[model samples]
Target: MGLLSGVLGNASEIEPGKAQADFAQLLIQGERVEKAYQLIRDSFVFTDKRLILTDVQGMTGSKTEYHSIPYRAITHFSIETSGTFDLDAELKIFITGGTHIAKRFNKKLSIYELQTVLATYVLR
Candidate 1:
C-alpha cells in the first residue's frame, strides 16, 4: 500500500501567487490563469481562453507534454465527489471530437470549485 498511499496523497491545490514559474511560462501572451492544481509532477491550469494540462514524465522529470484545450471545445464536464467507500474525487472533461480527460484528486480537494470554474469559462 506504500505506492497507493503516495498516489492518494498527491493532490496539491495550487493557490494564487504560489504557482510555479514553469507553469506560468506555459501561458500565452494574453492568457490568464484563474485556477491551478498540482498532482505530484503533473498539473492542470485553467486559463481565460483555455485549459492547460501538463504531463511531466520520465525518471528524472525531464520530459513534458502540454495539452491545450480551448474553452470552446469543452462540451461538458462531470465531477464525482468522493465517498466513504471511494476515497478519490474525480473530474472528467469531455471535449470536442469525443475526447475525454479525467483527473483524480484526493478526497480533501474541492472538486466543486473546479466544476464551477470550468462552467464559467466553457459556458461563456
Candidate 2:
C-alpha cells in the first residue's frame, strides 16, 4: 500500500498467504484465508469459515484484539463503488444482531472481488 493511501485511511489488498500464516493459530483445522486487506495498523482477513478482524491498540501496539464473525452470522452486506469524484470504495456488513462494520478501500483494490468472496461464503 502506498504511504499516501495509508495516511488517508484507505485500505489496500494484501497477500492471502501472509495473512494465513500470521493467523494460523486462530484458525480451526482446514480453515484457510481467501483474501486479506491491510490498513495502517490493522487488518481484515477473510477465511473459508469466518472473517477475522485484527485491531492493534495502544501507543506501543502491544495490545491486540481479534474479532471473528462467521459467514452464517452475516445478515447482509453492501458495496459502494468508486465514482468519478469519489476515489474510495466502501463496504458495509450487517451482522445477525444489529452489528454493523464499514470499511473503505482505496481505488487500487477491487470492491467487486471483495463482494464476490463474501457472497461465495455467505450465500452458500
Candidate 3:
C-alpha cells in the first residue's frame, strides 16, 4: 500500500478538529511526520520515460520507466498532544538530504490540507 494509506489506516479514529489543528501545526513546522514516508516515495527521482533517444546505428532505444528509488536524509520529528484524551496530535518534521530534492521544490502540502483531503476521500 501507499504511504498515505498506511498512515491513514493507523489514524482511523483521529478526531476532526484536533486533526485539523494538528495538521496546521505540522505545516508550520515542516511536512507532517505521518506524511514523510509518502513524501519521500512520491518524490523519488527516476529517468523520464518520455525522453527520446536514437542510437548511432539508427535504431531507436526502448522506452524505459522506473519508479521510487531510495534517497538519504537527516530527519527529526516530534509528536505531541494537542488536545485532551490524546485525541489530537501534532507532528513536526525537519529533514535535510543531499540527494533529496522534494523540499527544494516545495512540493509538500500542510498536514491540515492533507487531513481534509483524506477525510473527504474516506467519505466518498
Assess each prediction's global lDDT (C-alpha) against the native.
Answer: 0.80, 0.94, 0.30
Candidate 3, which ten residues in sequence have the lowest lDDT sum? 45-54
Highest TM-score against the true fold, candidate:
2
lDDT tens per residue, model 1, 16-123 = 455545566777786677788887778788877888888889999999998988999988899999998998898889989998988888777788988889999998
User: Runs in model 1 with CA error above 4 Å?
Assistant: 1-6
Query: What lDDT score goes with residue 20 in model 2?
Result: 82
Which residue pairs collide, candidate 3? none
State the lDDT at 43 in candidate 3.
Answer: 20
Model 2 regions more than 4 Å off? none
lDDT of 2: 0.94
Whichever of 1 and 2 has more lDDT, that candidate is: 2
How far in Å is the alpha carbon of 11 misplaced in model 3?
Answer: 4.9
What would the C-alpha RMSD of candidate 3 be, to one decimal place? Answer: 18.4
Please provide TM-scores, in order, for all candidate models, with all chains considered together.
0.85, 0.97, 0.21
Model 2 agreement with the true structure over 1-124: per-residue lDDT tens digits: 8889988889988898888888889999999999999899999999999999999999999999999999999999999999999999999999998999999999878999999999999999
